[model samples]
Target: MADDDDEGGFGGLYEDGHWIWDDISKSLVFVSDLPPKPVEAIQILAKAPTGTVEFRDDVDLIEQIRFRRRYQRKLKPGQEDVITVQDVKDIALYTAPVQIMSPLLINMLHLPTTERFIRALILYSAYYLQIADEMANRIMELEKKIRTPDCDILEHEFRDNLADLRLLVAKEYSVMLIGGSDMRKFHHMGPAKKRRSLSDKDARLFETLLRMCVQIVWLALGRKSFNQIELETNRIFKSEIFNAVEHTLKTGYINNMAKEERVVLLGHCLRYDKKLNTRSPLMNEVFCHRPIDYRMMGLGVIKVQQMSPRLHYMLQAVAGPEEKLSELGVVVGILGMPRSAFDTMLRPLPTAVEKSKASMSSTSGHSSSKSTASMGKSTTAAHKVYPDVVLPRKETRELFYPPSFPDEPEKIRPCSETQRRRWQNRLMKLLHPHR
Candidate 1:
């Protein structure tokens, strides 16, 4: 860490209405006017200059031609102006694709560990939402401008803003590091005189937030997966199981293991997948099903994932098919497991897929075409694990990612009543946990 007066110092953490740190008292402070609530912050972001540019559905062929003509730039000194017929064709066919920032971390309102923590969480959410919204808006602007004469100028502006946005993101993360310190006093009213790094639990939360930022940035850059981003920020602290859960969300698998190796992997995934409400019977079945079952011991999958590396090495290849256990050593080295676990799961002759397939085959098809279509749907559904927690898809799409400009009246109102109720419930819990 740098000195308070220098660059990357504590001075950078202070913003008029976000956070402040008092040197004499050695305590971090929250500004009286914190950032807007999550939803309101999003609304604020959506009103930015570029944010107002929207996707339109009524652009005619003549309008596209006009747009293209406007974008034709004058050649500079020593520059060749080469416009091929293909270029014209491309301009005529171009249509902007609707891009969306992944909502997993953006919309999620976690239960803060302390009441004081809520302010920091909300502030961070505001910053994250701002950057995400700006990036999306800039993209839309670029799409529109690229077909007009001001394309070059607009591109320059977009580039400059992109750099500025990255800096804002860094400052946001810094505030989290500073804010996570314990600042409450004996009376719990004023600041404490002790300064320290974030606690273990708080550090985990910070790491999660950092990963979210990275994921969103990568998505905005048009990357399909966060693998590169995740690897780059690997040093950020997170429990292995939690890391696995994130990996599963981005990629449909846990660390690219083979089918047989997936038995334990899938089990861990099921245990850690945040989508499923834990009390569900399916969760119990997955917990008891085998390889890494922690039911009898009363331990959590996360605890096991973070256990001693030496213990994992011992249990790495205890049982299971030869092919699946081949890389089990490496898997165990990274994620520890219990002894006799793999052997227990291996005895079940048929895999989950085989069972599902057999059941489908047993049912005779009413018609060939219907059967074929049904099989395809079933197979796809079998693979896609729909999230148990359904977000306000309608609202998110309209506010954060409207599919079309001049959004229809029906599309704009009441994003999701369910989401509203859930957020209220979470807020109540955070504000009055004991109640």
Candidate 2:
């Protein structure tokens, strides 16, 4: 029987046998009719490498297998991937570039609310820095043009562009400050319902963001204007908000300040005291207190309320039938949101009452149809077609406008001429300061 088995198995010591060469062992081995176990097959394959394999040790091989399998593991049903600190950092760094930053930052707003605040801080900081660099470059160009003896007239076009740029910067600064306060409140009373302090990394990022805010303000409004506004804010708040801000602006470092001090300083920056009036024309325009409840409009009630008041006002203002001081395009451009998205955001959501009413009407209509059918009455209701009132979607034509430019030029006279005169006066003062 053994002789017969050996002859049948091709010199193997197995019943119903086959023979296979073991490349690693460099010998013939008997293959059983039953297949090898997965582990055994893997070991055999690992040992009998056809080519050079990087994993030399069993531990390394196991680690490689785990690494590959890690990505393959699927989440359980209804399980959401949690956004960790690392994820936020990656997003922040990815959107740090100037060219791609704005749109990406705008998109971050659509992230899960849990992650939005931190992302907002980091991305907004980077954005502020980008705009600061741009404003600095523009200012340098204007200065160079002024110094040029051949350049006699400060062109309306250039001045207009600078003014618009300044206005954009101012609006952003105000929005940042207001948004900061909202973010703080949000985190403190987050979904967890626990007071969450910033991690060391987040704290550092927040400090840098606050510093950039100060820099943005300083650059947008010149030192003179900045000083006047700071003094007024100090008087109104009776706190060292702007003083700390000035120090941060000048030093470009907040490491010296304690965390509590930094927090207080941040609070001051984001604080919008109704009585507080900077009195400077530009400052007043930038930091106006017009508290409007967006919940009434049923447009992102919670999210919008938790956002910057100015931003809320801007959204509301743009949704108006009559064009307001801030154009939808300008707001959209400043926020880096696409026109379509901005319009969608402005679109009102139906209230719970309206939804219930709609359902009730639908049910009643169905019941009425059933009864009408039973009665054998074929009465069709006449539907009235109302004229569609198209809301004018205003698009910005020029890259720049006078500071006082309104949405509708026809309805409201543009103060471009006055702005031009002011620009000329400013240029004249720069040229002959002694006079």
Candidate 3:
């Protein structure tokens, strides 16, 4: 490996040719596609007099532009290609992250809904799904340019199928049961009489759907789950959210947060559950700062959980079970009840009418009126807008844990003694001057 040799010292291919690892060319690399890609980073060899190497916006000149990929995990002996945790986890150079928290978080840590997630829309909704579709396609083209030995490529492979995935998820939760003349016809019949709606159950289930969507989107964006983080992290996220809410309730101020803030908080909260040490302010902002996303509708519906006595009685004021319910009708608003109570109430009643109505447009009622930048796309808005139980699947594909029930918990484990000494020396280098 001579210095002048440009043949094989980690030379990666590019449109112009190949770039040797040690080659100090005056070039910059721009990394974008913020979401879902763990390392949405930009770096370049700054040819300035200082000759610094750092993030740059130029694509052509940059020497390296590796994407955070999601591909298959490597397996153990006799298990070639078997997906292991390392193959999935190691797929990061760097990327933006949001904090996530779920009481159900630990229970279903390994198998979050990401595998079965469907964020789709119809072809007619050109403006909405078109750009998304193009983005997905462009990602595929870029993927071919580079190949890492790890697994983030799997997530990259998912880019093209975003639209159809949503459709498939809708079909999974379609929950339509029909027989007789209604079922026999080639032509379609009307919606089911008894179906999921706000009033059919308590607000929690409705809210859970919203929470799940946010969690899913957050997960898709590669953020760590909050409950899975330190117990303190979870506390911080909730505290921040509540504090922000309190500010709004008491005074009038706005606090907005980024995806990173969420992840940091969740991580911090879980970091010191035993001690409850000082929390990260970033988490405070996220929990409280209202992200004006379509998920808000689901959040609002979920908000039914916090309903004052007046709101609860108001729901009861609605007409009898036989009455026709409008979109925001009582049936759609019963999101606060506990699952058992909600289910018990619906044991006899009919489900929401599963009308094959054309999809709702412009808004899915999940978004808050205040924010323009909402959840993933329009389709997810309507998907969770209508009430549904959306229980966690039995066989979740998440690599870390199983679905619903977790097996033995595994600690991340400490670095070895030799590795610890090397780590300490490195840390000391930045903090302490030479002897």
Candidate 4:
């Protein structure tokens, strides 16, 4: 570790050649090499006044002096950005992700322990879940208003509100996905020495929060099937959440676990997958039905139900008698599986038509048509049957007028006296909620 008062020291665990001591794993890890700095002479020359007859050659030396002075006043850890539990709670209640999530995420990286990180993650997931539920309710309300003939909300107002809500949902979901990816990356880097073992209680709560995140994601996608969500949302989901989950399942931070513990952990992963499959049939067909050989268990096959009792007991102990696991939402279920298992499970299986085509020299057009028809049926089945809040078939002109020009300010209409009174009452109600 570098001394705090040492001049030109890298500070903390950082050392020369981009190597840093990982206190948690008790090992030295290689950080990435620093980006190349521009040559001082060239930079100084480039910044010289245009077409100058004479330029000061000592500018580089002067710049170096200034840099050294600024470097001497480097911020202590106390001066760095800090986020508190209350700050996160307040942000979740009052602000949109667009306004604060990025800075909040950056500050969370400076959190000192695994427990604190998990707590922050849980708060973020809860915020996302709340937003998703609200959006769903708002959409339902909008649908009712659109159907009511006497509704006073103009077409433009309705469209603009729906667009704003959808945009908000997308932004919030993106932040959540990024946060989840960063959490997995941080965990994979090894735990901080101060908080080596995650408590079983925190672990279970983290798992529940992850499940809630998945459910919120599904809700944001309009509760559509995987295939139906393939267009806009699928790419983002796959790139961020799917990739993060896949990577974590493959290379977990379990280097310190004993052999028996590893086996039990693997069993838990399989058991969770089994339970999850029961909840999502599509996932069951995609990943759980296939047989996987666990080399950690000496290439032995373990039945999905073999570990059920132990997992149930663990859940029961953590959750107590009154709570149901189902209330936590959909399980992300593959967090602890090995990389080989994940790859095998994700591999696409060939259909009967493709198998027959390989055997024959040429395939009949009938086979292609039949496959297309089946695909259409699946698409239709996956598609939302209800009227979409976003897309309406009937096109109507906006009821609101365009903005008035500065020269013709009289064209700008003022709010009606009734509308002004209504807004005043609403503001008063907000100010005095109990009243």
Candidate 3, residues 267-308: lDDT per residue as tens digits? 221223323554333322223333212221121112334333
Question: What local lDDT does model 2 show for residue 354?
Answer: 46
Off by over 4 Å in 1: 1-162, 180-198, 213-223, 229-435
Clashes of each: 5, 0, 67, 0
Please tell me which model should have the higher lDDT, number 2 or number 3.
Answer: 2
Clashing pairs in 1: 55-405, 70-148, 70-149, 71-148, 71-149
Cα lDDT for residue 52, candidate 3: 15
Error of 3 at 419 (Å): 27
- Best candidate according to TM-score: 2
lDDT for each residue of candidate 1 in 1-435, tens digit (9 for 90 to 100): 235776443443555567677654678777778456653122221211111222233567686565445432233486333321112212212222122211222232221112112222222222222223233333345546644556444433433322222222233233233442222221111234253432442333343444443433332222222343343233122333335434543543334433222332122223443543332222233234423312112111112333243224222212111233224432211012221221111111234335534544544221111101101111112221110111111111222323533311211111223333443454455447899
Candidates ranked by TM-score: 2, 1, 3, 4
The lDDT per prediction is 0.29, 0.29, 0.25, 0.28
> Of the pair 1 and 2, which is ahead by TM-score?
2
lDDT of 4: 0.28
Any runs in candidate 4 off by more than 4 Å, and if so which? Answer: 1-166, 173-213, 216-224, 227-383, 391-435
Go through the candidates in order and give the C-alpha RMSD of each one to the true structure: 28.6, 30.0, 28.3, 31.0
Cα lDDT of model 2 by residue, 352-420, tens digit = 224434544553332112111111221111110111111222223422323542232112111123323
